[model samples]
Target: MSGVTDLVDPPRTRRPAITSLEVLCGLLVLAMLFQGRLAALLDVPALRTGSTIFVAVCVQAMPFLVFGVLVSGLIAAFVPPAALRRALPGRPAAAVPVAGVAGLALPGCECASVPVARRLIQQGVLPAAAFTFLLAAPAVNPVVLVSTAVAFPAEPRMVLARFLASLLTACAMGWLWARLGRAEWLAERVLRRVECHASGGSRWAAFTESARHDLVEAGGFLVLGGLASAVFNVLVPAAWMESLGGQLLLGVLVMAVLAVVLALCSEADAFVVASMPGLPLTAKLVFLVVGPAVDIKLIALQSGAFGRRFAARFAPATFLVAVGSACAVGAALLGGA
Candidate 1:
């Protein structure tokens, strides 16, 4: 009976356990095997164009990313968590604007803001204030504003418009969060993750680990965003952009959406927007404001740092507020659209 049962069922086969390294190696081998075919496919004009854009965006954005991670690592390692708590105003309302203004001090890109924001929250700074800094730091920082100036050499008001719109968005979001956000919404685990890492080892070890971890995590999302932008640049019809040229409201809405999709770094988005000369300044202003505050890459980082619940609520609210802020501020500062 046993032999019959064994024969009928056959021996259960054990599958090989695959480590991540093994899986990665296997993928590399597969890629190598198809290298010739892949090269030929890539030679198609659209694909070639897309690849070029992808590489260009990645190259342009990577330095800022690296700089941001370095700053983030330094914050994690050397800056005592208590320093932030002591530095912030006791009142949440007052703290929010202060945090937003303080963002100007950090010239790093949005990639650098996530971990620093999380660190602030974990270290006893008000969540709302930390969030404001997160939004404002990338958008209003000198590096970004200067880049905007350089990109729109002819229209320098773009610099001021971007700064005001972004600062307004950050402060509004911060104040809103203070009023409505529930502490329970943010995942406790995410907050603790950074704290746990920082608690152990020497400052050097912490800095290196924080920097390395942040780079790996943020870099992947940045690359994904760059690839998406490249694909859109190549595949989205020029006619689509042209159609919205003179339609102020529609142009603003579409550019806001593009900002969310492109996820371009604050330091570099100005250049991309500059290239689209057909779009109204109001629309391009919205793009500049929205990209740094909320984008595919920023959302990913925010979700990782602040939980999906927080990110979902925060990102859309910030987007709507940003568009309104940009429109109102643009009309006033850059002349009526």
Candidate 2:
């Protein structure tokens, strides 16, 4: 047993570092070997279209991403966790709505909300309330609202429908989680990891570190999402989408699926949906509500911040609710057209 244990736990050694020269030489070798293949791959029409979309998404989302990081940093530095605990209403029922509406104050995209929500949950805020904020922040925020309004300039009611649907979807999910969610689903260790880093530094230091770490982590996932979306946008024929548009229920379903697949930024998704003139307003509304509340990129972020179990359960639930809420709100607001 002792020998087995010794063999299993061999001494660990530090990995040798690669110098800048070594990295450059390796890059040069790889480029030299792959130059012709790389050029050929770049020339493919589908690849070119995909690359263009990827660049456009990244360029469009960067400002909002930067702003979100700044806001997240500020929250970490100045907004004490204790303050949230005290400021929240005493009951979860009351707290959820308050938190949902509180999302209006933070105009960052969904990418920024994941880290902030994790931090809030770690700070003793009710998990339900924090989750509500997580869902609502990107969807109901002023920036997103303005974008929606701009996208549907002719139909001002679209703005109202989007806001109401998004808020309802978010609040509903919070209530559902409060009733059915188990503590075991959450990755509570994420909080501990955050706290460990936060404990060693001043608020300012903690703020910078948390902000930087979150930006890097979330940004990578964002790029991956963008790439996936770009590829789909280029490969999936527009006529296929147009064919799906005529049937109301089918359109809603397809748009909801596209929302998850595209994972467009909340600030810009309205425009993307609006670009498809073939889709009905109701279907577009579904796209707007679903994109912010639940998307592939958001699922990945949630899994990182919360847990895979949580995301697996929450994403589907949120998608269903978002679709229902959008349909109901669209019918009511858009007169069943």
Backbone clashes in model 2: 0
Return the TM-score for each candidate structure: 0.87, 0.87
The worst-scoring run of ten residues by lDDT in candidate 2 lies at 191-200
Tens digits of per-residue lDDT for model 1, 1-337: 8878867966779999888669889999998999999898678889888888889867877787788778778777877766767898989999999999999999888877887787677667899999999999999999998889999999989999999999999999999999999988897865563443345568789889878987887777777777888888787887788787778889988999999977777888899899986788999999999998988878877777678898889999999999999999999998855
Candidate 2 similarity to native, TM-score: 0.87
Clashing pairs in 2: none
- Cα lDDT tens digits, model 2, 42-66, are 8988888888889987776666766
Each prediction's whole-model lDDT (CA) = 0.85, 0.84
Model 1 lDDT, residue 276, Cα: 86
Structure candidate 1, residue pairs in collision: none
Top candidate (lDDT): 1
Reference-based lDDT, residue 304, model 1: 70
